[model samples]
Target chain A: MKAIKVQALSKKYGEKEAIKGIDFMVEDGEIFGFLGPNGAGKTSTINMLIGLLKSTSGTIEILGRNLETQKEAIQAEIGVVPDESNLYPEMSGIDNLTFCGSLYGMRKHDREKRALELLKIFQLEDVKHKAFKAYSRGMKRKLTIAAAMMHQPKILFLDEPTSGIDVASARQIRKMIEDLHQKGTTIFLTTHYLEEAERLCQRIAFIVDGKIVKTGSVETLKASLHDQSGLLLKLDQNMANLKQSLQEELKLTKVEEINERSLKIVWPPDQELTPLFTFFRQKEVHILEAKRMEPTMEEVFVAITGIEHSEEKGGES
Target chain B: MNKGIALLSILNKDIRNYYLKPPNISWGMIFPLAWTLMFVLRSETEVDLIEILPGVMALSILFGTTSMLAVTITFEKKQKSFERLMLAPVSLYSLMLAKTGGAIIFGILNAMVPLLLGIALTGLRAINWPVLMGAIILIAVTSTFLGLMIAVAAKEVFEAQTFSNFFRFPMIFLCGLFIPIQELPALIQPISYVLPLTYGVDLLKVAVGAEGILSVFLNFTLLLVFSFGLFRYSIHRMERNWMN
Candidate 1:
């Protein structure tokens, strides 16, 4: 059974349509990424799937149960790590974990034991007795994720798991997420970090302005943008009068003048580069650097959605 | 998962997190004693402690319940921790009951200071023990639910406090806590009957061998109606907010 299946899902806050009839599914045991920029409706869509918000239209089936009818049942089997920590700040980390387990109906002894194990696993055992409010931002987030794992949920929904944190903490969380996926758990992660999506997700959906613009694996997303294939040339001297000559002789599809000494030639992937080299050599505008520009997920994301990923511009907090 | 455990889990967490904090404990302990002293010092005549006991107890429950609701409901809503509780396996009704359970218990405990003081001054022989216990429990439940009603629409802890004071200060004057309901103007008597604290304090007065306008049956019945009505209405409103 699919871990989640949402069809024609929409959420409206009065006249403002937040999620405009989006459709997607996450298969069991697969890590699915919902990639988008801020205010792209990623959080809204996840909230609806987790039953925290009711959809204005359409249906959500989580673990083969209708969310509208079996919200508590579905929720019992799924765990959500919201964009914020959402755990009690005044409570100790171990206390928070055991309390979360109790909400899932675990016995006191069992919950205590599980909480200890999780504390050790999450590398929080040393400070398990400290209040959650006393922890650093990274530690607080780790505890929140650990609390959500108290019941060993089959499917985990994480929204912006590594959006704003120290680099080491982000890396640690990514490793932990990879570990969870390896242990046969299905993960549905929403993030604006395109590199994270490319690294962690087997399938990804690009959301923009409350709509699903594209959905595919990392390779497919990049390959589909192959029409943007081009050769980049860096020159030793300013293009001077050579820009017109190269454009006219090469009959290039498009030439992007990157700087005084460089240009991007949108040549077909199948086209030969020896001719361009000969043209450049004849003109003695020595080719300092010449190569195809491989598109990163960041590039594919910007190409498809027309919105830059925040992390790409170092705008992350 | 067994839902009873889930309900108790939320209750247990809330008690540990907010209700049992040191400042609230100190407030609960000092509120009744301070009120008792004020009442004793105010009256030039030899004041029978039993005559004013109902008012002090009712006010204690009111303050205790409303203050805790500010922490349990309004604060959790602000922090989004309540959303985590909504993800639990328990039903919405059970979840709300668990969330307010701490405040109800606190309200009852708050009344104990005055009850002990009353016993020391006037002795337990004059008090109707069974009816008084019922009255205390009913008052706690009804006031806790009333606090829930105020907290549902509030976005901040201070907002809950302001809303509670708006209801609480008026009920102090109108609920026959100090003055008889008949002494109030005819226009205000109808308003007195509508306040939940009116029935609660009247029941307390009846249990304490003081002159009370309402019968025990009517007091208990109205308190029950207000308790469930306020609880159901608050839960309905909160459920909408939680889901959205």
Candidate 2:
């Protein structure tokens, strides 16, 4: 079952289209990553899905309920952590969570118990009594996440969850997300951290200029590339002459020498590797190490989008 | 039921924060006391001081409701906390009601200090307890609604301060606060009738035995109408500007 389904979702701010006819689906209990650079409609798309900003034209279904006609129902089933910490600074962390939980009609005792458990999990128990204004950036982020999870929402929408956290905290957060997924929570995450997406997400959708350009699982995407096979060959010394012979004899596509003792080869998937090894032994090429290379997500992304993975500029406040 | 729960939670949180900080409590109490002391010291005669007592009390309520409310909301806006409230399940109407209610409660408490001082200093007597309660409620409600209007319309803290003072100064001056509205020119009397603070001040004076209860009720009704109209306008503006 699809937990979140968006069809032709578009949002226009004045004359400019922030999200133009974007479509995607987040399957139940799956970790879905929404990938995009700055100003690439990632946030706009998430906002529309969560009913924060009305869509210009489209349909969004959360937990099989239409967002337009059943916004209250949809919101009740989903949790949202906006890009910014939208907490009451004058209130304590525990107070913030309890208030959020009460919005879902949770009993005071249950809400208090849940809030305390979450505060301890997020390592905020010591500062639970302190006002939110006194919390650090990482602590505030953790508190916001805990607040969202207070009701055990079925679908969680997290926008840039690890954008500003330290390395240790980011790892902890990733582990927490994994735990939630294990408990059958469907997560829809948006972030610029491609490496994080590659590590955690089961599927990813790349959006650009208000449209989805690509969507697939990591392995499926890597397999879809035209150049699916790579070879890393380490040769013994004084085997330079065999490189030219192997290229001519085996019809290799391209080869590059690495450090005068190693070579990298690009070949088609249909090509047999055993023949190359047999030929090398017959000609006595004196091979040291030869292994197949798995493609990284960066290469797959660049291949699919036709753009390099440069860092996003201009931080959003 | 959800709306009620959300409203109570928000109100309780606001009250806790307001009281937990001693500085806010001191400021709320001292502003009215200082104003009363200044009025007594600056008067040339005891009769003159007694005449200014009602005005000083009204002025204290105005400051407590308008300036303090505006500054607090300005800070919330700057911190983006108001946006957080908008995203919650609570209706905008309930949120506005909670905000206005909290501000009015604070304003009434602030007004009581100077009110008690005026009675002790001038030997002012009260005829009708019900009428006095009604008038106090009227003044607090109207001033709180007006404060919300200013808070919602202004974009920045400095802008909120300027916008509050722009109307508050004239309202305080012509509403029989520092000067009696009847002593003003004929053309200015019409202006005073339109200002909510004029009705508030008149109602307060009547409540303290300076006038009849009937006159106080009349002014209280006008202030009620002003408050209802302003509350509606502020809610509309807040919904339009922030809830999108």
Query: Which has the greatest lDDT?
Result: 1
Superposed model 1: Cα runs more than 4 Å off: A234-264, A310-317, B42-47
Report the lDDT tens digits of candidate 1 across residue range A1-317.
Answer: 88889999999988999899999989999999987776778888888888778899999999999999998899899989998889988889998998899999999999999999988887899999999999999998888999999999999999888867888878989998999999989999987677888999999998888999999999899889787778898988888588888888988766878999989887768777898989978987888998887677887888888976654443421
lDDT of each: 0.86, 0.78
Per-candidate TM equals: 0.94, 0.84
- For candidate 1, the docking band is medium
Per-residue lDDT, model 2, residue A291, is 81
Query: What is the two-chain DockQ of model 2?
Result: 0.34
Question: Candidate 1 at A261: error in angstroms?
Answer: 5.5
- lDDT per residue for candidate 2 within B70-95, as digits (tens), equals 77777777876765565556556777
RMSD of 1: 2.4
The true-versus-predicted C-alpha distance at residue B60 of model 1, in Å, is 0.6
